[model samples]
Target: MSEPPKERVKYIDTNLNLPYHYYAGDYKALYLRALKDKKILGSRCSKSGKVFVPPVIASPETLAPCDELVELPHRGIVTTFCVVNVPVYGREIEIPYVVASVALDGADVSLYSLIQECAAADVHMGIRVEAVWKPDGERQGDHTDIRYFRPTGEPDAPFESFIHRL
Candidate 1:
């Protein structure tokens, strides 16, 4: 019998655009509303006294419903961070930026946000940073309302200050 030739497999590359709507519950709606005003709001748990930024409906630790809303300062400490060097889809910022976990003042929970206006090498745990808001007209009820955080030139926070957040 004669040998038969093998056929090679072909691969097809494609992209998909999915349109969908996200429903933000009352807690998130209020939080985003405050963002539009260039303000950060946190939810406080009466029992545990933990405050969550981007306010939550329930206490993360105890899972108890939280009802009190507290306004938070834009300034916070960088509890930890890492530099982004690799490019990935859906990234709006330029490559090599720093994403840090911040512990805002008066809030028990920490919020994660992009760190900017400083050298990546200069970023470190406990660095003080304050939000740089977008112009009033540019805000759209989102976290992006705060363009990014910049160095406040304040002394670094002691490890004990933000350890619980970690």
Candidate 2:
């Protein structure tokens, strides 16, 4: 006699929900206020003559309390950069984007961020870059407040212009 027909295999899709607690602080509030005024803020080390963006609460080198706040210029130079092709967190960002290390004018250390409004192939070490601020209504305390830096129309800066910062 013929065997009974075999049963078909089936799969199940499960959706789960988890619960947790979260906390939010006021740091962004202060930062937002500063950006709204179109100022680039940094924490100054009075004894060492060092400054840090986002105003660190303490000096990284000396571990000393940072009490002085300095407003830095919006313009800076690209010390180095890399091209980004993959989307982060499955989120899409303009591909072939240049992520650069920029040393703001008059600051000792460089900060890393995207260099927008230009071809990635054209971005290079020592390119002069200028800050592109977001519209007044879009102002936020985060790095996006400055939007991005683009090649300055000015002539390429001489090595002397940014070597000291490096």
In each prediction, how many residue pairs overlap at the backbone (N, C-alpha, C within less than 3 A)? 0, 0
True lDDT of residue 52, candidate 1: 87
Each candidate: RMSD to true structure? 3.1, 5.0
Give lDDT tens digits, candidate 2, residues 1-166.
4976587557777778889885423433555578878987777876687887767767888888767878889888888789988877864677868889899887878877888888899998788898888898888666668878888876676787777666
Tens-place lDDT digits, model 1, residues 1-166: 4755666557766788999998999989999888998879999987798898878888868988888999999898999899999987987778899989988988887888899889999999999999998997999998778888889999999999998885
* Model 2 vs. true fold: TM: 0.75
Worst 10 residues of 1 by lDDT: 1-10
Assess candidate 1 and give its TM-score to the true structure.
0.86
* Candidate of highest lDDT: 1
List candidate 2 stretches off by more than 4 Å.
1-29, 158-166
Model 1 regions lying over 4 Å from their true place: 1-20
